[model samples]
Target: MANPIKIIGASLSQNVRKPLAVAHHLGLDVESVMAAPGDDTIKAANPSGRIPAMDDNGFHLSESVAIMIYLAGKAGNALYPEDVQTRALVNQWLFWDVAHWTPAYQPIQFERAIKPMLDMGDPDETVVAAALAKFEREATLLNAALDGKDWLGGGEPTLADFAAGAGLTYAAPMELPLDDYPNIKAWNGRVMGLEGFKKTAQGQ
Candidate 1:
């Protein structure tokens, strides 16, 4: 309905997956570019040369979360919400994902996956250990938030769930000890059950 929005980023990129997942959740038609940092064409689309840029009916947007929010608005406000306070809370989690979660897990993912591909896999174990520790701490906080709620905000999952889950995708394959936090483990399963989540992960 929104002119088959274009998503520029690799399927495996967590940031890229954010908007991809959101689009799938909205049941919107889309075209993916599968761009990466080394791609010249993608560099042209985004001068700063980041993956996960988007072109929505000629309205171009970059930054993963921004693209997700734009698509969410187009998909209608269900994923966002009209309530001012709730919207603010969603924004808070989104900010937390970018500021805290991304910085923590992204580096580890890069070190484990991308770096090896580039033959730059030499990583400082101390740094990886610290990042993982921080991730665990934050995950505990997320577990607390999910204590008895069916979703992050309330009954229905919201952008907060999407945002948090996107950052945590890198941890899934690693089989992080999520069982310790039953609530968070359940939340992860719920997120993975979403069409958007599954599609972005390129899963059946």
Candidate 2:
């Protein structure tokens, strides 16, 4: 049997949870190490000092989205898919999460959650309001995308679900108002119901 892949990052992190959920869903053996971004452990594997780096049998890799795709591909899972068109669709949501969804939601998360937790003073309501505005715009797009579909890529949950869903890991804590986006709320429930997500949630 192959050695367990080392997944380096705190389990609670949304980025870390991305690959961890993929690993679990793909039935890949993985060992989670709790390290935060900028830590020396993470620095060795990712020059950018990012969390959620990977050491698969000594092959180091960075970036959460890349790690999730690699794990799914390595396991020959349907989550990553093989068809070009299907893969392209999945990639679209993955990239969207990194480029759009995350950017919109992260500021709200940092301000409402991370700031207070780290004794960084109270949240700047101005920052929160601006982020919420951006998040609402993005959520409208996502809600529309999920209007008739259960999953982003197709019928079965794919990397798209995992990648995009991670952005809402702190939705409640951050007080994200999801009531306005019923489609997203329903889809989120489905995504959270997956065994991989359930397993990862236990650690968090």
Candidate 3:
């Protein structure tokens, strides 16, 4: 196994869950060093002071997807896959998660769930409404893509699934409109059912 690595992030964070879930999927049982948002320690790990940075002994890696890819590679699993074409497709979805999918849900999560918990403020109805509209569009595309497939982009679950599906962690709390996207709803259940996902979901 690779030298025991330490994940720095809260358990509830969607990005933080990726490496933990990947470790669990690979049977690594890795430990994490909890660092919540706005923690100064996060700056040393990620210049942006983001959660989900990783320390592999002395080696450091920021970005959840990058850490996930490294963990998957270490595990010798095909979660990211090897075929050039397949890999490209997997990467495409990963990019989409970070760019399109994540952004769409972020406002909702912050405005609806997180803000209130942190005593930030009430959710902005205008933001929620706009996000909901955008979410519906993306969710529809994702739903159609997932049709008749057990996982995203076909075959077994990949980083794309984790990257995108993690947002659903806040789906209910943020009141994300999933009613119109049955395929996405069902796929999310399958992703959540994985033993690795279950084992690594709660942060210490």
Candidate 4:
């Protein structure tokens, strides 16, 4: 018997959800470890002090984005496409979220929402507002890309949607209106309605 790919992370974290969702889409059997705050297990596995570290057949890997791409390539077509251009498009959005959206928006969302809940003081209003403003701008760019299409790269939901949606889930509590971006709204709804999406969202 092989050591199943062990996904260690807090289920509620968006970064962790990316690979988990991909696993569900690919129907792969994986062992999930719900690493919690103050838990030393994850810190030991990932020196960066992050969740979403994995042990794939003894090959230790960290970082959510890297895990996703590795799993997709291993799972093949279910999540990763064979077409070079399509694969490039998926990678493009995945990179965009990491380099642009996640870096810009997640800190504000965490500080504003999660921190206060954990008894941490409220985040600076100006900073949150500025981040949200920037988020809205990039969201508008996404809306434009979604114009008349069902998904980011076209009809079928690709890894791009998963990557982007995982990052965007931070907005779930904000209840922002999708009316301004009908296509995006539809896409989000579609992604969220997947088999394990609700389960994953609920920290399954």
Candidate 5:
């Protein structure tokens, strides 16, 4: 029998959960190994020393987005899609999430959550305020995009949803100012309701 795919990283990490949710959604056999960035295991899989790397048999891969595409392709699932145009749409949101959304929100996460948890020190309110401002700008675009859509890509959930939604895993804990974005709040509810997301949330 073939070995299950190994995902190296902590489950609490949003990047780690991205592929885990997709794998669970596709019913793929996978194992999660908890490790943080800069660990030897992480370095072996990712030269940049990042968490959430992948080892399929002896094939090593890095980057959450790349790993997600690989898993979706391996499963022959529609999450990543085979249609060129549809896949492009998914790619669009995936790139946007990484470039725009993540940059804006991650600072808030690091300040409000990671710092406090790691005893790094009090959050820099100035930094938090700046990030929140940037977040509102990017979120306006996201909110508008989600106005009539349940998912980011199309009617059904796709890698776009998984990627974008994973970033919000700590929304409540981080106290993100999401109350104003009714559209985003509603869409998030749908994303959170997926079986794969639910299982990943429980660290299954």
Candidate 6:
């Protein structure tokens, strides 16, 4: 039997949730090695010291998207998909998350949630306002894409869902005000309702 996959990051992280969600969804024997930022142990594996690095045997991999793709390949599931077109669609959303979706949500999450937790001070209303504008614009685009679909990539949940929905993992705590985007809210409901998402991402 292969060694269990190692997830190197704290469970609280948005990026860590992606690969963790995929692993749980596939019923993989995965373990979290919980490293906070600046942990030299994790830095050795990923120079960036980023959360959510994966170690399968001795092969180390970083970046949540890359980690999810690798995990999906191991599980031989449709999460990443084998069909060229399907994989392309998943990759497109994954790239979109990194490029657009996450950037808008990160600032809001940091200000509204993480700061308060760390006693870092109150949220900057100006920063939250700016992020709210961006979030509204992006949420509209995303809600349209998810229209009449349970998942982003297609009928079934895929890596795209995990990557694209990572920010929503913080939605409740960050107070994202998702009432306007019914499609997005419903899609997130389905994703969070998954047994895997519940156990790994929702701590249920």
How do the residues 56-164 of candidate 1 rate in per-residue lDDT, one tens digit apiece? Answer: 6777788888988888888565789889998898898899888887787776777665566568857666767877798788888888888889787787978888888
**Segments in model 5 whose C-alpha atoms lie over 4 Å from true places:** none
TM-scores of the candidates are 0.89, 0.95, 0.93, 0.89, 0.96, 0.95
Which residue pairs overlap in candidate 2's backbone? none
- Local error of candidate 6 at 161, Å? 0.5
| Worst-scoring 10-residue span by lDDT in model 1 | 168-177
Question: Once all C-alphas are superposed, what RMSD does model 6 give against the true structure?
Answer: 1.3
Q: What is candidate 4's lDDT per residue for 1-204, written digit by digit as tens? A: 887788888876888888888877777778888897446777767767687988777788888888888888784464667788887887888888888878667867687657766778867777777777777788888888888877776668777888888765756555355677677787888888776466687735
lDDT of 5 by residue, 64-147 (tens): 999999999895677987889998999999999889989999999999988887899999989999999999998899999999
Of 1 and 4, the candidate ahead on lDDT is 1
Which ten residues in a row are the worst by lDDT in model 4? 170-179
lDDT of each: 0.79, 0.89, 0.84, 0.76, 0.90, 0.86
Q: After superposition, which runs of candidate 3 have C-alpha atoms over 4 Å from their true positions?
A: 1-3
Cα deviation of 52 in candidate 5 (Å)?
1.3
lDDT for residue 130 in candidate 3, whole number 0-100: 90
Residue 106 displacement (Å), model 4: 0.9
- Candidate 5 local lDDT, residue 93: 94
Error of 6 at 128 (Å): 0.6
| Predicted structure 5, TM vs. truth | 0.96
**Between the candidate structures 1 and 5, which one is better when assessed by TM-score?**
5
- Number of the candidate with higher lDDT, 3 or 6: 6
